[model samples]
Target: MHTFGSRRDIDGLRALAVIPVVLFHFGFSTFSGGFVGVDVFFVISGFLITGILFREINAQRFSFVDFWARRARRIIPALSVVLVAALALGWLLLTAKDFSELGRAVRYQALFISNILFMRQDGYFEPASDLKPLLHTWSLAVEEQYYIFFPLLMMLLMRHVRHWRWLLFAMLLVSFGLNIAYLERKPDLVFFSLPTRAWELLCGAMLAVLPASKQAVKPWLYQVAGVVGLVAVLVAVFTFDENTVFPGWAALLPVLGASALIWSGAQGSTWVAQVLGTRALVWIGLLSYSLYLWHWPVYVYANAISIDGIQHWEAAGWMLLALGLAWSSWRFVELPFREKRVLAGRKPVLVGGLLAMFALAVTGAVVRSADGFPQRLTGKALEYAQARDWRAGQMKCMLVTSDKNLDKACLVGANQGEPATQLFWGDSHAAALLPAIENNAARQGRPVWLYSMSACPPILSDEPRQRCKDFNQRTMEQIRRLQIKDVVLASNWSLYVYGREDGDRKVLLNPRDNAAEAEARMAAALKARVAAIRATGAQVWLFKEVPLQRKGTISRLTSLARVGRSAEGLGRPLQEHLARQGFLSALFASMSAADPGVHVIDPTPLMCAGQVCSIEVNGHSLYRDEDHLSDIGSARLSPLFAPVLLGTSDN
Candidate 1:
């Protein structure tokens, strides 16, 4: 069995893994599977470490203390320096909350268990996962978890079996089976947990079990297979995305590919391995650990600070700069302390190192509290977080879940003096119109009944009616039973009016139509629903859909004022990046036809000046989250209710 890693190949592998991960982070269109580099590392680590275990057991020289000590020596000095440096640098650039989260990440990193920490933090595969600076540490945690149990398992297995091959095969089978099962039933657990990851390591162990004669097999066939393996992994990296279920059967392409290259055992003689396992590449690989540690934090910090996606060429420059920083850290901080002669193998140094790591971790967590770092400059970040509450009671909603539906709670204004009130009903986007609904009710001096459900449009179900049937029934029952006089129907009309024809589920998350079918369906649905709802005896006031806004209303106002656009509070018309998209425009094209009961309250004046929709009014957030308006933003409806709800207003 191999006792030590071929430093050149190992380094080459490191180079391969880190490059794609870095490129992907910079938002490169290619190398989506660059993330598989982590898997490659896992396989390499498993093979090398398992090989080490096999040699020690065969020679009877294995000692757990010494093994763990070597691990501490190899992992801690460089890791500690990176964490502390990241924390210090992060303090300068990060917001209070970002700093706070950085602190928590640092602490968990110190213990080598950040995967579990993060899984519980923002959810496993959320879009927000991109924001985490220390996310890469999950791989280290997985390695540490394996290290904790692997040596003992090796010791026990050696006692039970004389030949190591049988034992390795059994362990491989167990780990692989666990991975397959977890991938299907619990992918998140598989993503973060070590049990699911052990199989990758076992693949390496399997490599070590092969006899030396087998390793030296006819070189050309080995050369061909090894090259094929590496290419397969690269192809997978180039094509795959985060949405792919990883470490599953699909992962076999990359893992087995790496394993095949390893099993080929090129030994620097084979032409392909010679170029791949070159001194320069290996040298870069030797520093790959440090590079991996530094690259992610730099990218995350850039994103947190940038106003938008960093332009492509600008991100490329960051990669070069990150390489420089990593090389410097490796040369200056890691090499000197790692040597055995300087510290004389004393135990206190380890203790000191552990304590120092723990300290940095603590600093990361505390630095993001309400009064944490930069909060002294920006007041309390927690207080700024309070801005979400600005639109709280002022607007009533059907579901507190999504802005796409109207929630019953937001129409509180409609409950003004009267015990009984009018009922408002529609899909999620209807929530945005609640400010106007409540305003009109308050003017009428009566309460308004509230009913809202996500994706439950008021229109009768069309063609395929599989989902939300019971929800529609419940909504219909409530509308008929309530002593309701008026119904305000508002929605992301583009979603319903332009339904899908290809497949039932809407592939796009937003309300816009990308293809011909969605646009057509969106318009047809709006027309039919408005006409049908108006058919009811109730007075139907259709609030023309509100424009979807982004950016904080306050920040936009602040920016406009800085440019003197808001000099008289008349900011230059906000850019029309997105107009009232899809069906809302089509509905408006044929909508205004002097219908008395079917009144359409359009916020075109408040939202659009000329043709652009502004996200801010009076330096406030227009939408609380995504395209939905904030509590203060709902006040934009005040104008629509001028003659209907309140005497004067803004929507």
Candidate 2:
């Protein structure tokens, strides 16, 4: 019904937004903050879509059906192709469990709620997210959710509210405030939810609806604005990293920067605009949508199949493949649907899009219900696929933060009704040792009480979580009350002291503490805890943490099996494992020497040999994930605890 001329600079801006995202996802260090490209895309979408809505509404030619049909035509065609292709690829490459997850992701994406699905699954910056081929679709989902609602809001406001601009501004402010307030408390929710992300889009909407300038603006002002805008975006892309608190105050840099560029280029071109309007950039921008869609899956699948991680050269090759696919997808899939050459009418396009989505949803459901077609794999591949799950009843025994009651602890081994003589206590790592402990205790005719909690160490100190403190306190009281003769302390000690590879500070002993300070604090807390346990006349067996594998390494075991590739030499170096555990190993040694009642059980000697700390034993994986031990792996450690279990120790 109405039209505004296309801006080549805006198209080029899309290239600017997408290239960094591709680089970042493919592990380029220079573009660590390339994720801000999504923010740029959001602003551009907001400005263009709002401008069209404003024009059509003003001309009294706006129709909700027409608006939705246009959006479906633009988005659904390429997305459908990607989804189907991803499923086909998944069938060939994924394990049953992973294929099920991919099916679940497809189900959510078809409904335009993959953002919510991912929010509940993993943080955007987490290593696990790198394995997800459709992870980038969350941004698309956010934009689609906006498209579904914003036009109706605009119509309602135009019909009833005279001061519509002020209302929209107030909404933006409210959304931004929510984003900042919950950034620390609920980062995932703030990152994925439409409410918190609305302000970024609203910035562009506000720019579109701003009153036209009555006076001819001086060219100097536009030049200054354009340069500053481009600089702000580039600075964010180069300087920011995963550690940055994002989509809060930090988001203003990209959101306002895109808005300023749009405003500056509204009437005439500046040098910055000319650069953006270059033919190469314009072409990349035209292919941006398909490029974004294609790149992540390419990266994910490539990484999945590699024995080691993808090197820079391998990444470069994969990116070339992505680019070629993006170009083909644009030419064959996006253009025909978008130009209405395939589904030529509004009703046909809308109906066809709906049917496609429905088909995908049903297909995903069937895949999920069938458990990702486990029949697709046999032999070692099937075995590897099944090994990803934790031991049966492991989840039931592991207490999380909310489970504060000590009576809820799982009792294993013999004589369950009588007072327990031994206890297994620590975090999820300790929980993983349940198979070994239970089997040993059963043979010894000793009942062991398990007081393991997720992320909660057995040690007591000034923990940020009061629940952990209380759990530890209750555990101590239980030792005294039960007259427990033995206490095994185990946890992911390195995680509390050094944090995760993804820069997750929340699980650290103190997020603000330096590495040395964290190590010192943990040592002091653990020493004090051992003394407290010794006072109860119980022997403390300090179980050293299992060696951690590199992120995404374990998944490669099954992935390799699927492709008939050997997983030999697929383990971390022993030196790296020893180095990570150096501090803890020395601390455990000192604690044991100080008091014979406190004994150290180091798993390294059994789990490692020669030069490598192996992730598998005789074709069976030792780890269920990067760091946690699998059930079969845990059983291999049964001998280490035999002295305590069988009452053979002199202590």
Q: What TM-score, computed on C-alpha atoms, does each candidate reach?
A: 0.78, 0.88
TM-score of 1: 0.78
lDDT (C-alpha) at residue 448 in model 2: 84
Best by TM-score: 2
lDDT by residue (324-402, candidate 2, tens digit) is 9999999999999888899989999999999999999999888899998989988887777667788557889988866
Residue range 1-651, candidate 1, lDDT tens digits = 443655566668778777887887778868887888888888888888888877887799988876776677677777887787777656555544455677778878887888888767654345455557788899999998898898898898777867757877887778778888878566667777787878887888778756666444576787787789788789888988877778788888888888876766533345556666888788778788888888887776655444443578878788778888889878876676567643447475566666777776667657645434544333222323334443544334555443443224433564455544255566665665566556656666766655666666655545243344455556555555654446666665544543332222343232354556655665565566556555555556666656644322233232223223331222223443234253455455456464555567666577666644655444454555445566566766766654544322112
Model 1 lDDT, residue 103, Cα? 76
Which 10 consecutive residues of model 1 have the lowest summed lDDT? 551-560
The local lDDT score (0 to 100) that residue 456 gets in candidate 1 is 62
For model 1, the superposed segments whose C-alpha errors exceed 4 Å read 1-6, 85-104, 120-126, 266-268, 341-346, 360-384, 391-415, 418-485, 491-536, 542-619, 641-651
Residue pairs in clash, model 2:
none
- Candidate 1, after superposition: displacement of residue 429 in Å? 5.2
